[model samples]
Target chain A: MSTQIEQQETETEADEETEPEVESPGERRRAQRDERQAIEEAQRETEEASLDDENTITLKVFRYDPEVEGKQEPRFDDFRVPFHKGMTVLDALIYARDHYDSSLTFRHSCRQAVCGSDALFVNGKQRLGCKTQMSELDDPVRIEPLPHQEVVKDLVVDMEHFYDQMEAVEPYFDADETPDDKLEEQRQTRENREKVKMSTRCIWCGACMSSCNIAAGDNEYLGPAAINKAYRFAMDEREGENRKQERLRIIEQEHGVWRCQTQFSCTEVCPKDIPLTEHIQELKREAVKNNLKFW
Target chain B: MAQHYSSFDRGGRRWLFQRLTAVFLIGVLAFHFMLLHFVNHAADLTFLGTQARMSQVSYFATMWLFLVTATFHGVNGVYNALVNQGLTGSRKNAVKYLLGIAGLLLVVQGTRVSLAMTTLV
Candidate 1:
């Protein structure tokens, strides 16, 4: 694609040389720039015209702004984007922003699933926009901010609450004691790492929390990502037994893992393919066993 | 966040009991249905036949235990559902006590009715 654009730029430069020179040097340069812009405009128009319904995809994006007078009321805007084989929902959104409405707004960073910044409600499901292929979705795709979260603007939802829940679990690993030697490493067994491996894959995309029905209804529920974070540290062998017990108590609280209905919505929407519900269940079982030991 | 120090308030005990009762209910429910609908047949049910079944100490004890567990399971499920719906504060306490009283009344009435069916009572 970069090569194609470069070829077009060179061709436009060659065409500029053929024009008769009458104006001053600076004026000529300005005239040449204007002509090149007009040519680019015409090329774009023709390219768009040729990109019939078959070659273009339609995106209906949610628009909202509490501060903008005309845009205060939420609405959906449609943009026609030229489609390519590997184009994703995020690609279409970028095209719409660049070529159509510069005011179009959304959150995205790496343009990959790793950033976990582009989670959106696409076609009635929680998904990462950068990870969802345009071809996999139906045409006239609908995109909105993740549900159960307060919309900040356009496709951006307030993620402060989600971050709070994640922090509530104290996601960082705290070991009981360090090795006597400064250079000694606190290594984990292969089996122990494997046990907590899936739980450690949370990208904090907030998709699982948005997809959970119970989380939607219960404002106090810790939700799946937080429980998975707790699971990650609680199951780690290096963490002290006291730390593990504290983590278990946190998850076993009234609004913690017990609130999960095992609906599998979190697991289904997770971009990392983390078995979230299973981890929550494991935590519940661990909590129960700890209590039984006392009994 | 509410700090839970005791096992009673941690929510784990009720969660475990709910699962335990659910497992017990599944088996006992199947047996109850099979006994009533398949073996005895609804058309063949009579007061005397019910009395004869209730007269056996083993069967009577099982039925009573089933009633108690079923009440706890059903009531606890409803309570949990309410809590998950963001029920809180005094309203949540009200619902908790109301549901508890209702469950107790149900078990007591159930036991009395079962005793009325048995000659030993």
Candidate 2:
């Protein structure tokens, strides 16, 4: 009885293997033709759907180059790019660069908003190109380098001054003590981490700095980004109270947190959604509190 | 690298003063406008009526304080705006002194005007 059952199972397996070869050549051809026709129909539907005028977007890109003869006089170049769902400003710019003109210049990397390289003045506001969705912007979207920074060349601003201000803040952790055990790491409370977490999100994209009217006016003003950087470390529990005092002193200068007018533009334009004015305001309070202790 | 611990570097005082003065001005200015425009009416204001209001010690004191605060706020605002525009060195110093003189003149003249009003009433 077991031999009979095994033989029946083997026969079924052989039938499955020979099933494909059993089909006639004419039937196989007809099946292949049906498959090709279905694929073509899908392709046709997609093409027809994308044929609408609304599916294209126009971009007015700022063009300038002191070295290049033609672009020496600043001008705007119009680029018409096909619109797709979930497309970003960075995608449109990349398409324009590749298909329209190879000489079009801009800085971008990691395309994921972490590198902070592609902050641009879009429609008169500071925005991250990669993070901003094209569908949200008006047609003929205007793209330009950040205002108040020296334009290096088309869509690229000289970031040296911004870097200098960021460096001036000493954007690093400096704790006075370490654990006795060599393997132990500094422990921070959940509340402390939560406090500084928003400030720590800053990617140094310079968007907040560019949006700030105070930063644009006062060259020496530490700017929102730097102050926020100071806030991240100053508010950390592991940094010790002494280090916090030192940080406060650095940010309480004439051109430091004092220069902020609570304009709220920095907070509004922050790509990371950091409450910059709040941070600066907090630092101001801390400085005053620290100063009053002398009395 | 050398840390300067000068008291003059304290911008917190000025920022606090700006906010404090703003709050005070909002109340006093509103009262002033209401008194002159709504309660008393500006068209019917006479020298005697003006004097009648100014002669009160509290009113006189408030007006004097208003004059001082307004001058400071205005001049300081202009100075800050200029500094934000990258004013530096001798130019900044020159603007500072000029604004200081202007503020002093405004306050002195304002006091004189108030005193004359009181005497006339």
Candidate 3:
């Protein structure tokens, strides 16, 4: 495969140790690996030495790789990154990867908070890595993948479960009826739009779900983000009353809004400042009111 | 999804009842504590003194309601906590019935004790 060739190329170029023509291919490969190990040891020493320097910031990053023999066990790798005025946590991670170790892996895009690809556990809090500044954190910023999710590799977690929960809520808006004319428009009042405004801003970053205690324990719980997603559609007046009732039914299931303890953990960690707990409470009230009407 | 049509299966009723009972208990619990501990000194109270208080129709009803609400709130809270801790399958059903029976017995025995204290029964 082409990937095999690329792997070989990187392996050979990893270290600049002079190779003698007399050695076998196996021997050359071993020598190259040894040189790479020696480089890692030297880098770690420099990483330790820079801790005393005033200009550099220490980053304790969680590292793991199931496929790599030595890295199979989870551990924290320290990187010494030069501090800058407006440098964010993502910038520091990028600098560490580019300058010190190319294998330091993390997901990042857009360099802004909109992409929602860089949610990380920074300093014992869930935060957007690109939005969190290094100056605001303590000396050694501890960065790890979000908790309550299986880590796929270094700084990347399995988001499949989060996606599954989101899907279970039937997040798409479904109107009960549409106008006969194709050109006709479905309009929403300013009040209705304003009501669901904050709930619509969710970026599916998984930070709220990761921060939720109920979602962590009850695996079947729909979670804050998914419930908020339901809130957005369920509150929209454009979706007819029939659809709203249907949406309410979905969220009112045994593991739905009832599982929420109103801890506000999701609201506190939301990057978009969505009032998650308040929305969940409102849904609970709505479900009860609907039931009372039937009774 | 067809099963979700009924309001009872949605869990909203119990959730609402829990909050309602919590509000009621908050007020009643303070009164119970104050009456027993502050207003009527526990050391000075005897069996006849308690019977005299329980013999009053209004007092008997209040105490009975207090006992029933406390038992429901305490047992329901415990069940919710265990459910939230990922209890499921047959174990969840076992806990549900166990708590239900325990709550029922508590209410029954509490009524009998309250009736024994009252001269009206």
Candidate 4:
């Protein structure tokens, strides 16, 4: 990939020399310097691209097999993909598989942000590959698997634990009692609906959970995503008094609301703008108030 | 998930009592030291001195308040520190509940001891 990038640069340089120079001394010198700087930056970018750059999008995928490896040291693999207008990191990965190496693996579905698949460490932050455009990033976008998760393969993280924590909260709502058929539509205040509407928007993407430092050491923690799940129902007026108290009890467990340290990372990374910290704080207040009533 | 399980949960009350007692003891201990050591030294102690202080109901009340606050504060602070260190699971919960019951008993006994020391006895 480096040789190809070098070859492309030399060819461009040779083409520049062939063209007749024009303009005044000052203008020509500045233009030449700018052109040289641009070429150097492009070359430097390609070199830094894959951890190995070629002339294309260099992807440095980290590989580790916890079971098969002797010492389990991570290594990067390189691939140069043809650049396209508005090409996404996911698009580049797909192109790498079709052309260079078929074994280069990653996850994607729906090819849209809604599926919550294709979340990779694009540079140093968690981002959905389908949503991040290649043109918006420097050459050879450094694609690695998400951190704090067991990688099943190249880019696919084992989401079983994430799923289990989510399920433990029983994400499905259990209403107090069915509304009478005589009164088909249940009435709710507009203010109450809006208050919990943000919490209800959580997609269970586990993006917030992965960023939380608290969840890193404690496996018992229900995590921000699950706590937000509890908040959704707990704050909902439609759930009624019986179900509301039940939701509160779930969140009031030892590994629940008290576990949150108001870190706000959960709120920052929530794709749906769920206001996770605010909801967790409210749950903590609810827990405190519930205790005080006994006095 | 159960209804109002937090009522019996002792986490918040311990947190509050520890902080409150720490604040109270700062003032009460300073006042008690000045009165006991410098203002009315043990060399000048007498039944007249004891009667003079205890007869004033406010002074007797303050003495009991200091003891009750210090006992609850010191014991509950130890409990909160243990809990914040990842105390969970059934066995830990059993120990926690036992500690809570023991703490309540201590508070009851300590209050009685403080009342007995005061003129209220």
Give the per-residue Cα lDDT of candidate 1 at A148. 96
Estimate the TM-score for candidate 4.
0.61
Best by TM-score: 1
Query: Rank by lDDT, descending?
Result: 1, 3, 2, 4
Candidate 1: tens digits of C-alpha lDDT, residues A201-258: 8899999999999999888888999999999999999998988988887888889989
Best lDDT goes to which candidate?
1
Candidate 4 lDDT over A81-182, as tens digits, reads 667688888898887776566766677887777787777887876777887888888765788887778887777788888888887777886678767794
Error of 1 at A261 (Å): 0.8
Clashing pairs in 1: none
The lowest-lDDT stretch of 10 consecutive residues in candidate 1 chain A is A14-23
**Model 4 regions lying over 4 Å from their true place:** A1-56, A65-73, A83-85, A134-140, A182-187, B1-10, B14-121
lDDT of 4 at A60: 77
lDDT per residue for candidate 3 within A225-259, as digits (tens), equals 99999999999988999999989988998888999
Taking all chains together, the TM-score of candidate 3 against the true structure is 0.86
In the predicted model 2, the residue pairs found to clash are A217-B84
Predictions: Cα RMSD each: 3.8, 10.2, 8.7, 11.8
Per-residue lDDT of model 2, residues B1-121, tens digit only: 1132233466777777777899999998999999999999999999998988889988898999999999988898898778877787799999999999999999999999999988534
Q: Relative to the true interface, what fraction of contacts does candidate 1 keep? A: 0.58
> DockQ of each candidate's interface versus the true one?
0.54, 0.34, 0.29, 0.09
Residue A148, candidate 1: how far off, in angstroms?
0.5
lDDT of each: 0.91, 0.86, 0.88, 0.73
Model 1, range B7-84, lDDT digits (tens) per residue?
A: 435999999999999999999999999999999999999999999999999999999999999999999999999999
